[model samples]
Target chain A: MVIALCVTVALAIMPLVGVPKSWILYIFLFFIYLAMANMWNLLAGYSGLVSLCQPAFLGLAGYAMTIGTWLDIPWWAGMIGGSLIAGLFALLISSAVFRLSGVYFAIGTLVVPEALRMIFFLWRPVGGAMHGAGAGYMIKGIGDLSPHVVYWLSIFVGVGSLFLVKGILRSKLGLGLSAIRDNERAASSSGIDVFRLKLYVFIISAIITGFAGTIYYLYQGYIEPTATFNVRWTMTLLLATVIGGIRTVEGPVVGTVVVVFLYFLLARYAGYSLLIQGIILVGIMLISPQGIVGILRRSKFYDSIVKRMK
Target chain B: MIYGGDIITPILMGIMLGGLYALIALGLSLVFGVMRLINLAHGDFVVMGSYIGYALMRNFGIDPILGLIISIPVMFVLGFFIQKYLMGRAFAIASEIPLIIAFGISLIIQNAHQIIWTPLSRALNTPYSHMSFHIGERQFPVSYLLDFVAGILIMLFLRWFLKRTYLGMAITAASQDKRVAQLMGINTGRVYGYAFAIAMVSAAIAGVFLGMTFPFTPTSGISFLTIAFGTVVIGGLGSMLGTFIGGIILGVVQTIGGYLFGPASQMLLVYIIVLVILAIRPQGLFGK
Candidate 1:
């Protein structure tokens, strides 16, 4: 798609552009959200997991980054290791978590992040006096994790997520996940190994989301259990996916771009950012469950009335 | 640590606190039973009630108990309209839409409260707020006793209303099978409207107790939402009396958790209890 080419070109030339470093940072954050939404879409939109625990992986990756760096691991390696650990932990928990069906599964997943936050909050050995595993441990390891490194790494991860998700969607896993989503009992009867497929998607999604947090903390050079594990992260991605259009490839991308920019502008300019965001969210869901992409598809402009004539 | 008062006090207090939690969770169970919708804003509505009740106390010199009584009818009406208009419309569109709408509603309510009340922690700072009576030489807050009694009365009233009244049976029948109830010519919409209104009354009662017992802010709803949900799940879904007992059990566990591992660990312990209960009995202890 032309959109992908434009994004690739933008990523390539972004560093050379004579813009303020803060603008670059903002765009980098946008890319991070893009990836986060993709990851969530894979699980929720495709597999119907509907987990509210993405932050658990994010926090884990972040805490792992700090701890790994403290233990003499390189910053980049630590971040990767953190993602792998989050993936493994997700795999381990999926057995118990999978036993739950529907909303209970969602609530079960949520409890994981909350419990982890509490542990990280009270795990004084890492954080010292801080509420979560503090930033003090971070300072000892990656000295001045330059802003440029973070920005580029974020873009790289963002692109990586696109390919990663695309590959999965093209595989047997994707077909199986689609089947599971439509009807669990039917899929199970068809011998799709529904549980295993679901677990795989869950873990893969967790890994990607874990890396989103890693790059985030690596950039900020700080991590807190409460902030890192906030349910808002999950909610934001859910909103983005819904707005973009669930079960569509380009939906998250469009949704993320619109959301991140709107969020930036509103928080900066609007006096009542949350109130406005809430109003918009409710309006969007109520007026159109298909989301922005769905709306766009229905529009005469995007539908290309001229193409039909041709 | 060994003192008789130390353990006895928390257990009794927890039992009292459970009554309030039960009142809060009662509405959630009712709504879920009847319409199968979870109003994430249930906690916010409860907090809103607290704010209203607090205003009644501050401005009109009303007792929180009496304030609760007045708050209930107003809340019922408000809840009725919201269900009839906002949530009812959302449910008509899609199942998932209501949840998302509820989330947005919660966001709006929280921010609106912030804008209006200015989130500096507020509570019912009245003379009787801290007033207590002695129970076998152990101090017990009078408000806690009142809340306990109120919770029990609400539960009793709900039982009488559901089992004895035609409207109650209609609502129950709708909850069990809306399509069947509709086939029988019961007005399911009106039943849901009443269910939500009754749920609001429950939330208002909890709000009154929360105002009396603890400081709360605009952001206070989420924690209470979590607690109320936990109580519902622990107590078993669709059973009002079970929800009451679940609330009490949660309170005891929370207080005991605080007692053994300091205050910060209380929530962790409560979450553990919820998970364990779910794992052991997914149908809930009294679900069937």
Candidate 2:
């Protein structure tokens, strides 16, 4: 815990200490991805909901924030409001999607963003005439804010997500979630409110994902339907969580760092990045479905560390 | 009479369009019904077929329709190996593992297409690509007619193969109960491979038709997958007859919706219809 605090302090102070702007940007991206991956882990790794509708929340929140800014709302307030809208959207679709189980649920949710993409493309809620193929909107205001402020916001959400996951896992709600993940019928038979527990996790993840997305678009200073609602978002989250540890608290952190590194490393080769990531994902799943953390857990080093801690 | 033409023409076009949609849904329905595996990459496979046809046409001067003679066999072999090796192994580990693997395959195929073909839209151009038949005041594209015929023929062929062929019966038995089929001396693994291969054959055929019908990019796979999935769900999973009817329903809805609200809202309407159907009957129209 002391080590974690020191790391957070160091991260918080890096911008003030005259770090390179590129480094700050990289860290900012890492924090946002970590937050998103953490929430994804909470849902898929812990609660057993392999949702593919994450782009919907992310995109919706982005649009909300952009539109909110257009209406003279502050970016921070828009961020909160956008997240709430995402949560509400989740609630609205939950009844329909929750009915389907496993892969069907994943697919059912996958179409939500596609539907939203079409709607946004067609309906210019706050815009006049289609600008381009995407019909995107530029975020109003927020031009004067320093990168440090954005970086700080990302840190709060990123660290906040980590602590949030830790809190949930240690709480009664976490226990119920794991129980539900293991066996829904069994959990319900044993007096757990399976539906309610799943819904709670679902809404929570949606809201946080929305929050992270809002921060990302805020940093980018633009929001577009095609890019925002792109399936690549979910693909990134899946790749990160699955590659890291899944079900483990440190999984998203590890995964996000690797993914961000890969993102920069492969930034020059835009076409091949997704292909390489796909290959990595398939290779990892085939070789070690348990992921990096899972592999780590079985190592002698991990075992020795556990023994020493005990 | 002019007003009648607008309504009647769209409905006619929709019916033909639905026939093609049913063909696209066939492979997805078969895979899901028999193996209970939703190949998320199924649309990519269809798009791959289009690329294969495109290659045959560009390189060898073969017609896209004639190119299917090579593409069908190629896809069949690819499907067999993918199921026999990758998906089969993944299934042994867990049910959902294949789904993820399929997603991986989708990403690979989409990116590979972008890399190889460039991201520009392409379509198969036949000699009669622009030819249309006039029925009174309305003109129907020859491609649509050909698509409808090919779809019906394949459906008929599938029905016959499943009923008459020994391998087909084995597939049916295995789909019914893997363990029971194994006990009865059928190699369930091989049956699964064959079933998947056959499904790929259908996807290849559908891909060629789809390419002929519309211009497509590497990223067009997802939209195709959505259409196939919508067809399967609306028709009923694993039921041949239901797929036909369901494809028609979706086709009609899409066409009419497009007519009423323009092209952008077409997919949105399909999605709404799918969600509504799922909410009302998750088992689908013909699913047990």
* DockQ top scorer: 2
How would the docking of model 1 be graded? medium
- The digit string of per-residue lDDT tens for model 2 on B1-288 reads 011336778778888889889988899988998899888899999999899999999999999988988998899999999999989999987776788888889989999999999999999988896699987889889888877887788888887888799998999999999999999999999999999999999999999999999888999998889898999889888877788788888988888887777776876788899988887887689888
lDDT of 1 by residue, B152-201 (tens): 88888998898899999999999888899999999998889999899888
In angstroms, give how far residue A249 of model 2 lies from its true place. 2.4
In candidate 2, list every pair of residues with a backbone clash.
none
Q: A120-237, model 1: which lDDT tens digit per residue? A: 8777554333423332334346676667778888888888888888899999999898888888899999999988898898889889999988998887776777778787787778
Model 2 deviation from the true structure expressed as Cα RMSD, one decimal place: 2.3
Which ranges of candidate 1 are over 4 A from the true structure? A127-139, A268-271, A303-310, B1-5
Q: Largest lDDT belongs to which candidate?
A: 2
DockQ, 0 to 1 scale, candidate 1: 0.64
User: Candidate 2 regions off by >4 Å?
Assistant: A127-132, A303-310, B1-5
Listed in order, each prediction's TM-score against the native is 0.94, 0.95
**Against the true structure, what is every candidate's RMSD?**
2.9, 2.3
